[model samples]
Target: MGDLGLFGPGSVTWKVHAEPILMVAGLRALLLQTLHPRALAGVVQNSDFRVRPWHRLETTVTYVVTVNYGTTADAEEAGRKVRYIHSRLRGVDPRTGEEFRLDDPDLLRWVHVVEQESFLDVARRSGVKLTDAEADEYYREQLRAAELVGLDPATVPSSRAEVAEYYESMQPELATTRDTVESMLFMAVPPMPFGLGWTPLRGAYTGVAALALSMLPTWARQRYGLPGLAVADPAASMAARILRAGIMPIPRRLIEGPIYKAAMARARAAGHAI
Candidate 1:
């Protein structure tokens, strides 16, 4: 049998992922993701985030939303497109002087784990409650996305404990590199297209960037020479609440974009209430 789109409205993936705070979580994920030098190289070599940051942002968010919310066929097809893109890309590891494919499983796993952990970390800090079991379930269910990117689901971490262990095992491979700094700066303030540098827009972007940075794991922050302090925890929590409140009033149909709209349509067709 094939996969069902949306994993149904009841899937743990939907429960945690449907929240708006995930947009901020995406920034945190970007920061964590660039810490893996090889992965950073893949991005720096292949992506144009520096020149067209919003395009990169939109593409990242679109792929994620597709994998998590698209129909099984659509999700699989999306995965195939990503795999095809990766298959064509190669990069040299600056640290090791070795060449690598973008689709390398180890690198893929690093990308996968950091993205997952970042989303969960930010959502939980922002007050979307998931019991330990629910959190574990969300992790387990998220393996589909990993598989879509050609990762071996069996080798991927699928629970909170497993995720913790996975990160521990990979610590030796993580670091701060030039690419990491560049990627983080781009993610933090991005760049204003067309010279529109209004104070309110710039201030809000900086605030969100600070919030994302504040949510980083201490070791990750220390690697970047950033201080991840205790005070940031409560501050992040308050900011999270504010963000949640801001997005909560908007209808889901308005904020979630096309992939989500299609997913909700599928859910409705299946007689499921979204």
Candidate 2:
């Protein structure tokens, strides 16, 4: 009926991304990204995430929301800004002194792959019922997300098996750095606003963060020296499901971003049942 961004209302990407569990999925992706030394080095050198973590988080949330739920024009504009920033930023690997561009296809592809995997994995784990075929379709549909960030969609994995192979291929290149440790530690205990750390809200945040960490692969968890308890997996899933159950029913206008609202209104105006 109308433009519904890269993945429309009926698409799997929209369905998976709309869930509240993606907040944790995003954290999981961040944790996984740090396992790549080049990725960690690039971020440490280029981003101000350390000093203004909340701002960084806000910027990222806005980008994600806009790209996934905004109109095609808005999403493309967002991508242009991201690509411009990546094109201008340069950094060197702390471990090898090897220089890298933020827009490096390999780095961008790695980020895209891990991010999509995190979203899909967390959604399924949190009781979003997706069959294997639908899961693969989800990955296939997400190629547009990769393309939005300036990557050639052909370079990105388009299936679950391809994603696994991509990870396996990357394993030889992944490693830990001091920056990685600091990043993960920050994830574990990011600075709280004024007095928010003293309430049950803090524990709720911790549960989400721990759930994110628990979903990391054992090897990656071991690389970061974060405990990979066998029991944590099921517990994390339960926590995620509970959070999703509680959050998904909230009024959409209160929870969704303005761009999401606009797009949905457009779809509705076009006589779509979304």
Candidate 3:
């Protein structure tokens, strides 16, 4: 799952490339939550408005799990652990700022769905190549975990159209005030500290590859003196660049604000709400 580029556009290898690093990060988060639910709860409940500590924590954990253990079974287990910890935490209501249950159904659903989507998108982008049968299997496996989180299995969308509809129906419930989904998107990519263990070599390679790819067209134009060559075969050139450069890492911040907003806008234009 970590190998999947669902996070954003990059080399397919980078998606696979970043998995182990992400997995380690996830394991760290889960271990922290398991050991210190109260501290985690406190962070979730009282962090400053600008800093969403809980969201970051969740993202870290999810990335770790997805990268380390890509199977549905692993995701389900991770979900269960999150729910368990959430059940124990006491927090102020997000909307009302009053004492509230961390295990609130709505909140749980939001978290679970966001994480699930991240993993799914990664899988899709990485060219995991899920056939309808595989998709159905994936859906069924996820359904069991969704049930644990209080989500209705029936609510899970199986087809692209259904996914669009699901996003539409949840639009009202989704926060639009501060691009909450964007936060999820950005956070889904774990920070370096958390990701260091899984694929350090791959991570380094991807970063270098991305940097090289970014400079290739200019290099080609300047060195080879081939004006418009890059433009003429942009797609092929980009592909060649990635192949030559190796895997590249995309920064999470790039995906959150503008990119996410654009996606949301497009989805909305297509009659799907985010």
Candidate 4:
């Protein structure tokens, strides 16, 4: 159970996810996921996001970090909990008046792709320097996460080109519904835990929200009433480089939590430090 769950220490997922800029990528993923009416419906109907948004965000982050760095038993237990929760949730899609299960493969695929694509997008733009082949490998590696959510790995996109094709096919189904707008607004000033002063986090989160808007797909931006103005790609890349420079220099023991520390311990035991 102490073994790396699915991705070992050298995995592309580990390499990409270790960067702090993935926080931005995560915000982007949440933004993208809310665009799907059915998926958004499931969230709105089943979760207390409207009243306790940070709880949902924290739970999602915890699950991801656990799978990425936790032991096999920990990862399996986390996935099992998620599956159990999803299995019990059913919601009616407000837009189409159609009922859908939370665990629907199509919905899961949408969530998986948006999240994986966002992680890579932020990593690349922020100066992680992954080659095209490495990026594709990262996507291929991410199929493991999709599978954890009950998706068929074979149907998941495994490369940038395939991801683009998938998005193209999904464009007709994408839109800026009221839920999307609400989610965006909520994310703008994401609820932080009490006792941690908001003043400390407000500026950083505002920048993230702005960047999420700037980096959105043109059509999505326009639908959300953003100008669809493109920020030069290098801008995000440069910002990411600055963030990496600022963060990576800190010793892991000072900045990381238990999950990352355990992963590093495993790496050390395997004869290297991650």
Candidate 5:
């Protein structure tokens, strides 16, 4: 999965599904921080988002490029190849009880944009500063992939509003939530493993929680008694403990099933599914 060209040799559909995971992870990181503040101190350090890790950054940027271009192009074309083989599986749409088509451009664009915005917001809050030149470079490198997905480099939008307008134009092609989720399921899942290292899991989970908490608004931070306002740096201390322990064990069902589920449901209802 790591050796191919930027768009690989697959049908356009595969690239669509694969491109947004980076954005999803990035956005999730950002929202967790913005809504929780203290969370930032846990999972990431200052170095994780730097330009040096262009491969990692490319994944995150892909979504943004998709949103702006409806395909990979200009600044989002790097890292497009994947040679690892896996079995093909059917994708079912939960909402309509129908199968989702992998080559659907609308679905790809929607997920890409939403995920990119989410990642960008989080990266900024987490202190991953990007220079204008870096941002432009990212866009430039993505041109080839963008063409593969049917986007023209000359037509790419230059600003956020233009990007939003481009997305709105694609509404007719977008799939329902059920279809979108099915597409996402074919993508990657979290990196956590089951069993064998309970201590590391605990440390990681605790660290993630602490980082998410740190991204909350000031008032929210005060409510949690996080550092920089009321108490001495509780967030920092908790982070240190997480580092010493190696992994933080958070009950998976508790964090994912309930907490994350409830928040996402609320977000969807509020018209912010991205």
Candidate 6:
């Protein structure tokens, strides 16, 4: 019965995102984002992402979890923090002489759409049960998320068909740049930090990244010059389930972060059994 933030327990956003496989979706989003030259250029110019990739990822995850499960005030504050950062970032196109703001509506919209698409695709492919209507509802709910990062809500696609159409329309604008190729390779095997690069765990992480790559839509795979395997979707889904099951033995408290723990307390106080 307390404030449930931008999206409550009742929202499809909560339902779809509860899956641990969202970890893969995060990588997939990064892969998809690099396909856009402007977006990639903006990041290459303005971000310290290459040197501190894990730090950048943690920042992104913190904002997403706060928005998804924090109280109203907390969520708004998180959004404000992100918007302010975006407003300060600018980059010049490597291919053209043009300069661009990181928060240019066009760039914002592109990032929002690919990101949400990656979430839904990974969730469904990873064995989350969502009806067509529920899938549509998820996108509808994510429009609020799009708005959080400075996108116009009305400009974003709010259903599967619309998203597909949007992708189709944007295809001509998407091509692999040299930076894109480098980014893909970087993601495939991001160097480990703190001397962990020499550990066997680094090989395990590469296997996880491969599953994320396999789950990309055929068109996206094709764009990257990878084989567009008709069977990759199902194969990735199977792999996701196996991976999810393997992690399930870890006690919930051992892995759930402070944000998740706090959110669950709030939900319990509201009388939700979960």
* Candidate that beats the other on TM-score, 2 or 5, i.e. the better one: 2
- Higher-scoring candidate on TM-score, 4 or 6: 6
Model 4 spans > 4 angstroms off: 195-198
Clashes of 1: 0
| Separate clash counts for every candidate | 0, 0, 10, 1, 53, 1
lDDT of 6 by residue, 120-193 (tens): 98888777888999999999998888888888899999999999999899888788988999999988888787
Tens digits of per-residue lDDT, candidate 1, 1-274, equal 1234746688888877899888788888888888888988888888777889877888888889888888788889999999999999999999988999999999888899899988888888888988889888888888888999999999999999999998888889888877788778777777765576675778877888888888888777888888756665787678888888887989876777877777777777777777
Measured by TM-score, the strongest candidate is 6
What TM-scores do the predictions have?
0.93, 0.94, 0.44, 0.93, 0.36, 0.96
Candidate 1, residue 227: the lDDT equals: 76
> On residues 190-255, what C-alpha lDDT tens digit does candidate 5 reach at each position?
233344235575565444544544544344344334454635345534543444243225443542
2 versus 3: better lDDT goes to: 2
The Cα local distance difference test for each model comes to 0.84, 0.86, 0.42, 0.82, 0.37, 0.87
Q: Higher TM-score: candidate 2 or 6?
A: 6
RMSD of every candidate to native, in Å, equals 2.1, 1.7, 15.9, 1.9, 17.3, 1.3
Query: At residue 192, what lDDT does model 5 achieve?
Result: 38
Q: Which pairs clash in model 4?
A: 125-237
In candidate 1, list every pair of residues with a backbone clash: none
Worst 10 residues of 6 by lDDT: 1-10
lDDT for 2 (candidate 4): 42
Angstrom error at residue 261, model 3: 38
